[model samples]
Target: MKTITLIRHAKSSWEYDVSDIDRPLSTRGENDANLLSKKFIEYSFAPDAIFSSPANRALTTCNIFIDNLNVSKKLLSVDEKLYDFGGHQVAKFINNLSDQYNKVMIFGHNHAFTAIANSCGSTYIDNVPTCGLVMIEFEVDYWADVKKGITKMTIFPRDLKD
Candidate 1:
């Protein structure tokens, strides 16, 4: 089965003067990412590849998790399509993903992540909070054929201790 793991960028700090795309994550976001990394290790949910939005918030969160994951940096890539907040664009991006990547992780913005999770996963998640994680497993062999797959798991910062 092909698997895709989705992650919404961690909470961003509005206190910064930078543009939304350049805004960095808040302190709480950093801590949450670290906590979620531990959960990934516990669940042994290692992705073969990692993709992230070019935005600073998304990239920072990806880096934090990768540091804890001990995965190769070569597997990480930045995609412009992932920068979209709307789900449709991101959905197309996922649909066109290379079949070579069976199990991959994506770090992106909220509305897109939340919408994609609800549309693709069996679970009906109202919102995929900051630093939220959702894993979908498709019965198809190619990424192009992936559709309403099973929602293997959904995790968030609130599920872990502060």
Candidate 2:
């Protein structure tokens, strides 16, 4: 079995004059990221690898989660393709992952995240809010074996708060 945890980048700060890709996370975003990370730890769901988008907001969210979750594994890597905003592209990227990682975490943008969740037959709420985490489980032996409509779990940040 394989598990994929899709995390939407935290809220970005428009106070900066930089481009969208360079926008950093807001204070609220940082706090929420920390909270989400703690929730992941509380649930004992730690990924073996963390794939993150190169965007500043996404990177910041990944870092905050790493620190807050206290995950000792330093297997974080940046993927430029993840910067794209399409659910199909996201699924393609995930399907290409190596078999070494059974549990993977991805920090990226939305619309794509929501699309992927929907494609996997998970009923995600509108806009997977900033710092939101969606955990989807698949009963596949390899990443390439993943298919649509095979989701076993769908967990959101709001659900974690309960």
Report the C-alpha lDDT of model 2 over 113-156, residue by residue, as the tens digit.
88877777556456777887777788888999887544555445
Best candidate, TM-score-wise? Answer: 1
lDDT of 1 by residue, 1-162 (tens): 789899899899999899989999999999999999778877877688899999999999999988898888899999999998888888998889988888999999889998999899999999999999999999998888988899999889998874
Alpha carbon lDDT at 144, candidate 2: 94
Off by over 4 Å in 2: 149-162
- Name the 10 consecutive residues with the lowest summed lDDT in model 1: 37-46
For every model shown, the clashing-pair count is 0, 0
Candidate 2 TM-score over all chains jointly: 0.90
- The alpha-carbon deviation from the true structure for residue 32 of candidate 1, after best TM-score superposition, in angstroms, is 0.5
For all predicted structures, in order, the TM-scores are: 0.97, 0.90
